[model samples]
Target: MTTHEPVQMLSARLALPLVRELRGLGHDPAPILKELGLHEAGLRPLEARMALASWLRLHAASIELSSDPAAPARAAARIQPDAFPIPLHLLGSQATVREGWRFSAPYLGVGIDGLRAELIPEETRSRFDFQVQGAPLGPAPLAEFFMVGLFAYGKRVIPSELLPDRVNFAHPRPAHADALCKFIPCTLRFGSRSVGFEFPTAWLDLPIRGADPQLGQLLAEQAAAWLSTHEPTPRLADRVRLWLARNLRDSDAVASRLARDMKLSERTLRRKLSEEGTSIRELVAKARQARASELLGSTSAPLDAIAFELGFSSVGAFCRAFKRWTGCSPARYRAEL
Candidate 1:
């Protein structure tokens, strides 16, 4: 007889709060639950993930129902549980910070939305870029909440002698600046590209004790069992979206190009996209239309220039595409606003 080890799953910390917020906004989450085929009891603590697609839908719906466009920011501030400063108990005997980071990455997603970690190596020091996707409701308040987590986690694993090289963010808030400096004695740059950490490359070379033979075997067994039940790959639409989002400025994002980027043969890519309820051409058109709207509303560039920039052959062609997308000509779109 074979005994299966129970798969351990952690919910993103704010998931519960977001659910409550949705209900508070007078929206019945039951329709969403039914659509996702999720059980009402799944909202209980310690439940396994109810499909990544389901979570994504809930996130999108919550944002749409929000009166403020930046609702994510506001929700983020109060998202984490009150018992928030969860200490980073060393996962085994990992000596280096990088190892600790890798161990925590999957688990960190439990509380964070749109969080990503990027590593940039430099001669003297390296930078770890932590970027969060989508602007939430209250930017200032959210920054504070995240800082609490960052500081608490950093202070535990990383020694006090070594400090972050710098802190960079997308918004400027004096209160946040003070709180950030209180924990990290480093320079803070606001309105920067993304959130990241900088440290010495030598740090990576530090041996990780947590990778001991015993722990390695244990973790491997645990991981193997988990993979047996999970989907284990990116959904088709998500892959296409990520690919196009990264390559939108290229202006030559043909289906073949996307196929190559995704490492799938063109025919295979088409088949997979078809299975996912979309096609490469439709995806590209959707991307361009969305980008066009954003640029038109956010920038003061001329219509012709904007069209040309988005890879249109001519201003007239762009106008036609825009009309097809939003049922309004570019001139009319501009006139209405």
Candidate 2:
């Protein structure tokens, strides 16, 4: 079979949850990943870019491989708000659902390539629309996953009894339509021109559970930084910065490890970064400083926890570094914010 070339790219993190759900359903995701030239171990460096085609193929494969016709919807419904990648988390952190969609719509490209979200206000209802531009829409399962995922997330964040007045699907009605209804529990309109939902205008003002404006601002900054690297061809320095930013908590961010993961020798990686007017050390520091500012400005987490999350050896070390970056202690920075 001729494989389709990816015309656009998205964060690999989007596939991790879906792949986990497929495994839970007793389907082997390895074959599908292999078929699409993805790493058999799993999509790694969660922030690294993957072909949009591969993401859609994974959805299609889940439907084909699983005996359950509702596999995709089930998987999406199981996704908790905290399990969402940073972009979606950014959306949920807004003070209200309407504000969340309004703020997050532009940054959708940070996670899903070719996807655009629009919030349209009506007199009594507001419609949120999802559209794929500059690429094929892929299979029906892909559309279902997007729609269901959003609704499921909304239910978790919106304080009121959540139900869309109307849900629209671009794909034709499916044989397992009943399975979808069980999860959605609202009016479902298939064969629609768009994929999204309409809810009461009043619901738009409903407070999001655990909404934090500070955290939302921090996440928005991270999303903006990630979106900057999604150009047709990003600079090496920008790519390295993004990688370090995403992996600071889990990975060491050492030069050797970064080079190995990026498929380049240490010397070559250094040379390339130098060509781009940066070094590994400089990029690492930049990532640390940016994340430090975000954590300090956003949360009341103790300095020790923040230090650990930023991969520092100790609170003292992080404090010293924070002072170097901003001429003040982390606590002081938070105080000022």
Candidate 3:
């Protein structure tokens, strides 16, 4: 049986608390959920998963309706440990904060997709970085929520003064920055390369409150079993395609960067792609073509802007490639549409 990795998805239960919190704050979440093609009933099941796009849309809509910039953070604050999905339980069971984060980082994808957590040990501090993949960052709300929610979860399990010294956000600072600080209680840095926080390295050894080695072992086994059943081993080619599509806008979609991101040597990456019946160049071309079609069909963006967005050297270069792919010029293609 051919198995594929989990696409951009998160457990539907991840959104339920936010929905409840929204309703509590006098915003009717039902209409928003319906508009997003989500039913509250569907999100109740532990096994139910929703597209990461849908999750971002839901958060964006909630913030818009409430007219509150810190709505996501507030909702996250209200989420108790028990309210979280199974994957989070795996984190809480580990012996120490560092072990919990490191051990549970791999399984977090089972509960929340499109987010990667890396625990980096620095000289005096440990940095927990959150990288958003497979989706747009979506107006800074989810990024805010994840950072704040991490601290909140840490406090529950670590039983100490568990505040990060600094927090970083990839998005620009919002007008209601103070509102976020009220929840995060840290020196917040905006316009960062990534989203995460820095805390005293000594905290890594802080014991998790009420941790049980036996329980941790059981949860680890369960998490592993759940992962194997739900998320199949991913194909290398699919991962390469995703990386190319996400990074193409930044003009960082080169083969070397891709191989490095995949943790493979360039020659090994090439050989693996050959085994998968594809090439990085072919995938990049297809990604550009697909993005071009979407832009042409959906928006009235200028060809030069589209070219730049697709990381082409110039409009002429893009035009040549488009014609080669579609057997027609971009102008003619748009006119025909």
Candidate 4:
């Protein structure tokens, strides 16, 4: 399996939910950890992060062991204010949903549970979609946690009224469903294809409460320290590539710039990339090529402007690069998309 880095040390916000659930079950969490291939030693630390796989396994085990209808709700109640929520808290504290979304995204391990999230931009709006490819152990807590967190998070970023299209629970909500409605304002649908949130594209620019440059700097410093010691994720390259692609409009999308933000020297950054069998230039090109295709297909951004954003010196250079990458002109690519 292509292992991605385990999530950075989980925030107290995220782990607190699971801890509370285990406490409520009157069951020690160690056994659950054992069943899920995690060590009991991990629980000794307050800030330790584990594999997303272990989390899902324990979650599934909890549902099966508890077999109680109120399990998910009870677990969710552990998420009170002043919790870490892992990277989410850091992300949430950002100045805008866009910043938070981008920052928090790299740490989420949805694929560990056979799920993947996509941020799609439609003509009129953008949506965060969670697509599932496997059976959820109960999926109730996962859904509840995500829904409630998103609502609470929205309050810090966008207005609360703009909830998701619906909470796409694969199964129906529990008997206590009415109380769930109080958390978010959007329609709640059961048995949908996946769980996702749809918001007005304009909200992407909405400022967040924690968008301070100083705060961002602090977080960047702390996060870099945390990531450096953790096991490297194979998907890190893909992640870096995607982030760069999405933020291509930003001038500081280069490796050295990102390395600085990540609190690493350019030499160290290249070494890490080398360890992963990839390089900064390769990732940049990969990201630019993917983004160019998307922009060509989705927006009317001028070709020259797009080229410049991708760090090309001229339109002809971008065309040459694009042809080398995909054997097609930007115009043709847009037409195809």
In model 3, state the lDDT of residue 92: 77
- Encode model 2's per-residue lDDT on 209-294: one tens digit a residue: 98888988888887777767664454677567657856787645488888887899999999999987789888777778866765
lDDT of 3: 0.76
Query: lDDT of each structure?
Result: 0.56, 0.74, 0.76, 0.60
How many pairs of residues collide in model 3? Answer: 0
User: What digit string (tens of lDDT, one per residue) describes model 3 on residues 1-337?
Assistant: 9998555777787687689778887888888889889988888765678887788878877678788867877888777664576666777777887777777777776776545565656557666666544222334766777667667777677778767888878788899899988888879988754477777899888888877667767777776777777765557876886677677876654888888999999999999989988898888888798678656744688999999989999999999999999999998988875
Better of 3 and 4 by TM-score: 3
Pairs in clash, predicted candidate 2 = none
- Total colliding residue pairs, candidate 1: 15
Top of the candidates by lDDT: 3
Name the regions of candidate 2 deviating beyond 4 angstroms. Answer: 1-6, 39-46, 81-83, 134-139, 232-337
Give lDDT: candidate 1, residue 31.
80
Return whichever of 2 and 3 wins on TM-score: 3
Q: Order the numbered candidates by lDDT, best leading.
A: 3, 2, 4, 1
Tens digits of per-residue lDDT for model 1 on 221-262? 454454455423446766676567556656664777888878
Output the lDDT of residue 196, model 3. 72
